[model samples]
Target: MLTLASKLKRDDGGKAGRASGASDSTHRVSIRDRLLTKEVSELEAHLPSTCKASFPDEDKLHHFRLAVSPDEGYYQSGRFQFEIDVPEAYNMVPPKVRCLTRIWHPNITENGEICLSLLREHSIDGTGWAPTRTLKVHHLH
Candidate 1:
């Protein structure tokens, strides 16, 4: 269990291991970027009917406006707008979500700040944000 070559390969003995580790991190970043692209593509291809997202400017991909309309509820036929700012490290980190609508609710403040526990950074489920749960947990119905 103690060969020079084996130790070097394991990253505890030399430069080659360090280089390998750096490249592995780079590879992971690449994969995350690609996965995000795929998720965006999926969002584009299959958007929910009750909600829609629109960009404020054509050049920016990180910022957008999302609109939601509930068909049958106290807010039936009411359109609520929200602004979503997707961070660079999304999926691992949650996007910033704001109400952007003037409404009174326990979860939403009049100033457009949202109080949803799932959307906040202190969530009990895995350090506050899980990209996979964002879309599913935002249902108004």
Candidate 2:
């Protein structure tokens, strides 16, 4: 859940608190964090009107909740919540997404498992996850 910005801030704090024994490993930022920093901005830019994203902890961009208020359809005017977690190996792997609200949807299970093709790690049809795909794929406008 750590972002590059937070990591940098933490590193700065560590310097002021302790000068020695701070290894380079402690400063290493994950690829997921760097990707989220950019992808998150893109997500906000083109976010659909029916959808809204919230990060409970502003410093953790990799973890957030997405609220979907469908304007039309069987679930029109109803709000659905989803939690997304981008793992450390992101881009190389798909972000983990789970439906927080209990709903009867074909693509989403009651237990929060999602069946989106892009969420899959492998697929014979080539619709599975790819490094090029970003967080924006979850909210197809």
Candidate 3:
């Protein structure tokens, strides 16, 4: 009963609706995927071979852990753990990294927050971070 143009409109509407839903889902997944992939790669490259890091959940890459066993120095023979929380912006912004292991270090605060130049995302002037500076996990300690 419907004309060709009307039938095409109906079909296009259904297709557009389905496509819109799929696009939204894909966008959300990609955000998490991109963050996790980038974080895992960066950790693997920067972390010492002795240390191990991974994302337990493929969907939730924002949370991860690292195990560090110092070969020498005051922390020698001690196994330390760290938790990393990467924000949505990630590489463009600094991630929140903290030591899960209780260690007494001049750079680390009693509350587990690291007081390092690179870990700080904001400048002393209260302005946003510089675009060129990409801080790494090792810089925290």
Candidate 4:
């Protein structure tokens, strides 16, 4: 004999203090966010001396910037910057990376399109992105 609204309320823990609502305390963490928490820590632990990573928004680990200054290379005097964005599909797909600083590299185009084999989703040489690949900052070069 209960109304539709009453039934919904009863089913939703009406005054029983149950966690059936989407409250802030019950915020769900996605797989991507969970993986970034671990990967970001590992990245810091093994960061190279010539490379630096900075998160503009500490809460947003999915987006970050990288600075690279080679000590002994053709671009030794130049410090290059790159933007790395980890999509929601993380391990299933490669991170979208682009060069923020203009450079004339064979692997990178002038418009910031990267040409790394591992970044490719489908590569004929069997070097395309795979789920096993981690966010290894060292492999950026």
Candidate 5:
């Protein structure tokens, strides 16, 4: 018998079992898709008539892109792109996010690792992480 974690690590029949099992993967995917769809819709509806968010591939629903044009700042005219990656444990944990576009900022490292409040590991011992908040990113400027 394979452990639950081990089963989830495999790519073939393993996925099928988990996809149909009682674990969070199945429900996670559905909830994530719905949340993402709703988020995209809301963003589309209220985005400053200039920005946009879209999924490049229909098959890979976990990945999407956002185009932002800061209203103020040195990057005002520059178009910034961000890639969002929704993990299988979504709502329970924040999505893994990184700036795909090259940027220079005190909080953003040269390698694209963002040093934000939410992204910070909670404990100095690295044994605990903060609970996921509803809205992860508010303002990047």
Candidate 6:
């Protein structure tokens, strides 16, 4: 569990930790934190019309919500939710993405696991999902 005060603590770069002479370890920020910040900032600035993101626990930067609603497709008007977890390795390792909304799709399972070529870690040719691949947050059709 997390609270707003703690969330702000890190968001503020632990200035208090420094002032209190706390060990440097407490103030260290990982690469994952920086990357997540950029991603979160970009998403907040230009989120797509059919998609939305919410941080239920700000402390858990790795987890977030992505709600999608296809405007023109078989799934049109249907609300679909996807929980995205960005691993620390990020570009080096693909995020663990799963559907939270139930739907009948060849690539998506009833249990919510998705099997998209791009989302998959490995392809038939033994190639892994490109680390440079763009993250999609809207129109999952």
Model 6 segments more than 4 A misplaced: 1-21, 125-127, 134-141
In candidate 6, list every pair of residues with a backbone clash: none
Per-residue lDDT of candidate 2, residues 46-140 (tens digit): 88898888998877788899999999999998999999998888888888999999999898887989988789889878999988888897788
Give the C-alpha miss distance for residue 80 in model 1, angstroms.
0.8
TM-score per candidate, chains pooled:
0.63, 0.81, 0.65, 0.79, 0.61, 0.76
Worst 10 residues of 2 by lDDT: 1-10
Query: Whose TM-score is higher: candidate 1's or candidate 3's?
Result: 3
Most accurate candidate by lDDT: 2
The global Cα lDDT (0 to 1) of model 6 is: 0.71
Q: Give the Å shift of residue 120 in candidate 4.
A: 1.3
**Per-candidate RMSD, Å:** 12.5, 3.8, 12.0, 11.5, 9.9, 3.9
Write the candidate numbers in order of decreasing lDDT.
Answer: 2, 4, 6, 3, 1, 5
Q: On lDDT, who's better, 1 or 2?
A: 2
Q: Would you list the C-alpha lDDT of every candidate in the order shown? A: 0.61, 0.82, 0.62, 0.76, 0.58, 0.71
Clashing pairs in 3: none
lDDT of 4 by residue, 35-105 (tens): 87777777766777888888887767789888888888698878989898999988898899999999999
Provide the global lDDT of candidate 5 against the true structure: 0.58
Best by TM-score: 2
lDDT for each residue of candidate 5 in 88-119, tens digit (9 for 90 to 100): 66666665667777899787777776666565
For model 1, residues 56-140, the per-residue Cα lDDT tens digits are 7533445667788888789989999999777777666666788888888787877888776667656665545566654434443
lDDT of 2: 0.82
Which portions of model 5 miss their true places by more than 4 Å? 1-29, 120-141
Instruction: Decide which is better by TM-score, 1 or 2.
Output: 2
